[model samples]
Target: MEHITSTPTAKAPAERFTGDVYLNMIEAPASPAHLASALVRFTPGARTNWHSHANGQILYITDGVGLVGTRDGNVVRVSAGQIVKCPPGEEHWHGGTDTTLMAHIAMVVGDAEGDGTTWLEPVTAEQYAHALSSQGGS
Candidate 1:
């Protein structure tokens, strides 16, 4: 058991998200175990694009409000201390609520090679709008 070498925090790329987002990788398999965690912060109205994971992922809200949506037509509003899970290969997205900042600790189940996650397309404005409207917008 040893402390993993921390990597520099990086901006989440537009390819994987819309608006401004930052990520701080906390632990990775290379750092020690099968655990992989990152502190993800989203600016107001910022969120991830539609994507899926090979081994699934877990997200624990840490600050502000988070909006999580799935391909199954479910959209959830999660607050600090709340936790959400995405099943393997299920397309989903999560990010800050409109007009609010949001943050969460994201953990992806690692593969044998230590790489996990298969990111897909960015969620369109139409989709986001539909989600909010369906949920009655908080």
Candidate 2:
């Protein structure tokens, strides 16, 4: 077994997210394991753009409250210790609640060619507001 030291957290790009977000890359496909993982941190009201994995994605929430929404306009509440799964090629977005910070460990299986994800457009403010309302503004 190989022991890897922790690396500095990097700010997630604004082009792919809204509000403040940071990421600490854990295991990447370049390692012996052909999977990628990262610890993502989001400030209140922060969120990711629409994206999908070639295989699938698993999100293990580690702290605070959050929300995950699908292309069909279904937004669900996620709390600490909860896990959310996104099937292959399913477009989705996740983020912290308007009043709480959130963090999660994201795991994704990469394809043979090392291509794992396709990033699409950012989620609109209208969509986010609608999601929050769906959750009763919690």
Candidate 3:
């Protein structure tokens, strides 16, 4: 077994996120392994751009309330202790609600080439508003 030290928290790029977002890299894929993980924290109204994994992704909510939106206009509210799964190549985004901070542990499975995620266009304001309305807020 290998012991891994904690890494510094990073501010998520504005191009791929809104509001304040930070990520702590927990584990990276080692040779012969294709799994990576991170602990991500989001301030109110912060969110990631639409993206998908080459293999798949799993998110375990650790604190506060959040929203997960899909390409088909489906927005779901997820809370602490809930687990959300995104199938391989399924376009989706996750983030904190307008009124609360959110954090989750994201586990991503990658392909042989270590390509885990493909990020798409940022979620538009209209889309976010529609999602919030659909769920009647977080």
Candidate 4:
């Protein structure tokens, strides 16, 4: 097995996020292993744009609180140690809450040729407001 070195941290672009976010890639898909992983950290009120994956994504929350939302108005409030799963081709967005910081290790199942994410429009304040006000979890 070949050892993988640590990658430098990268700032998440504004075009794809609402606030400050950072990413530290843990692994990139290598031949025979088409899975990629990264540690993603988000500042308060920061989140990803609506997106989907070809083979789905898995997230293990590492710290603080956050929300995972879908276009269908299903919003899940998540905290440290939780795991959130997004199925293939299901558009969703995730990020920190209005008053909390959140960090998670995101693993995407796909090849290295691309980031494996199909990004769309950013989440608007109205969407975020509804998320914050909604009572998630049964």
Candidate 1 per-residue C-alpha lDDT over 1-138 given as tens digits, one digit per residue, 9 for 90 to 100: 877677788998888899999999887756445778899999988999888887888999999986999988899988999999888888899988777889999998676677477778888888888877777774
TM-score of 4: 0.91
Q: Kindly report which residue pairs in candidate 3 clash with one another.
A: none
Which residue pairs in candidate 4 have backbone atoms (N, alpha carbon, C) closer than 3 angstroms, thus clashing? Answer: none
Counting clashing residue pairs in each candidate, in order, gives 0, 0, 0, 0
Consecutive 10-residue window with the lowest summed lDDT within model 3: 108-117
Q: Candidate 2, overall lDDT?
A: 0.92
Candidate 1 ranges with C-alpha deviation above 4 Å: 1-7
Residues 23-132 of candidate 2 have per-residue lDDT tens digits of 99997786556888899999999999999998889999999999999999988899999999999999999999899999999999895677488989998989989999
Better structure of 2 and 3 per lDDT: 2
Which candidate wins on lDDT? Answer: 2
lDDT of 4 by residue, 6-117 (tens): 7799998899999999999897777777888999999999999999999899999999999999999999999999999999999999999988999999998786576578
Question: Which candidate wins on TM-score?
Answer: 2
TM-score for each predicted model, relative to the true structure: 0.88, 0.94, 0.93, 0.91
Taken over the whole model, the C-alpha lDDT of each candidate is: 0.86, 0.92, 0.89, 0.91
| TM-score result, candidate 3 | 0.93
Q: Local error of candidate 2 at 91, Å?
A: 0.4
Predict model 4's lDDT versus the native: 0.91
